[model samples]
Target: MPCRWLLAPGKALRTRFARPLRCDVNNSRRMLSFLSSMSPDNAELRAEVARTRLSVAVGCITEVRGADAIVNCANEHLVGTQLPYINLDGAAGCVFHCVDGVVHKRAGPELHEACMSLAIEEGSYTETWGGIRCPSGQARVTPAFSLPHCAHIVHVVGPPWPSDAEELRDAYSAGIKAALAVEGPEARPAIRSLAVPAISSGIYQWPRDMSWAAAVQSLGGHLLEASLRRGGAGELPCPQDGARSGLDHVIFSAWDAASGREVEECLRRWVDGTLTEDGLL
Candidate 1:
């Protein structure tokens, strides 16, 4: 389902989603509790979420490893290209580049050449996110080629801030689905988890509140849909086997405290179904 902003007065946000994966407050709480008890990979996020209750679907992280994929908030220039160098030789997960945060530069030299092969000139890329379909809201997925610790890289272009407000959710959700859609068990190590950033926050200048809300809602809604059923190979990994949707364990990486706090509160409201016009961060 395309990400819809479906809010009605007095109705819980959980139920407002396309599907009802969050059963009830009891279920939400239970799921939230379950997140905390997972393996070491998720321990910190579990603890963080418990203390803050900011988001049941979103996790804030300082470092990433073992995730099926990680998000890079790029720009037209793919700014902030720096990804952590853990093990360059280790074939790791995937990295979803949202915006143009120069992740390719850091991934390795040949990474840029691979992106060029996708043929997304700035004009076409911007046009796509602006609502025209060169396949609107779609992403170009490619093998990471030489980026260490990642097997593939999904590049997504979010709408230019202040212009395509409605498209942010599309960009976020598309980036994620594309990552999971990558065919092959050879891509296994990182297909089950994903990482993203606060798209449109920097040079794009999106208010921190909008960034988190769009992100969390997209994630929560997607997870619910996957858990309710199963779509094909392109589907985001859901705990259909009773594990968890790789999409559910989202990481909203922030560079500042203000953005961090906003994501937390915004995510909390989304989970609680309390986010409203008056409750914006």
Candidate 2:
């Protein structure tokens, strides 16, 4: 379970006359997004992370492709947002609150209609979804309907501020598991690739440092679980063991540079045997 985040600088973020070298911070103030991929530093880090089995990327969610599934960080109501953003510096840029709108919009209207129908009409049978509204820190799996590349979508509701870090971690884990469900009895998971965003990093104001750390933990667990399912409990798993898993990729796509860098470091440290002693989360 390697998570990838993709980030880029804000569109309106220009060098200020007074602080010509501080455009990064200036951009952070406008809206949260994946912003570091295009930057030289981020570009290098992205390449470095890719060398590892588990990794993170900084980029736009809409721009992602080849995933068998994608995650939608939804609210309890599972509704979408306008993904609005106003440039504090120049009144431009589109910051996002949730990825639901972007996923559904690109997937086409049928995707939204399916969600609405499930909430308002049929309701879900999953233990996680209690009727129309999904609970916080839980995930529910659904068909993509019109999303051409993805066969499924995992909708997870991240909790607001003040919730336990464990809760946030659980939310991510659930989403990943749901996204990697098997098609039928005795079948491997239908999803081979998956994409996720920074859950609860926006209006929820979840701490970026710990939240991203939790993300790493969740993905780590995902790989471990895959190993256990395929190879059993006694043996340790190699990166190649991941081939038995339904997922070939688990990308944590981002729109901001900070998250991208943070997740990349997490993967790097873990691979280098540093996370065990350094205590990242």
Give the candidate number with the greatest TM-score: 2
Per-residue lDDT tens digits of candidate 2, residues 218-268? 665455445436553223334443335645557777767977877777666
Clash count for candidate 2 is 25
Which parts of model 2 have CA positions greater than 4 angstroms off? Answer: 1-52, 82-97, 119-131, 146-148, 182-186, 228-246, 272-281
lDDT of 2: 0.58
Cα lDDT tens digits, model 1, 231-262, are 32234453334333434355566655776777
TM-score against truth, every candidate: 0.57, 0.62
Give candidate 1's total backbone clashes: 20
Error of 1 at 237 (Å): 7.1
Q: Global CA lDDT of candidate 1, please?
A: 0.50
lDDT of each: 0.50, 0.58
lDDT of 1 at 48: 45
Residue-level lDDT for 123 in candidate 1: 47
**What TM-score does candidate 2 get on C-alpha atoms?**
0.62
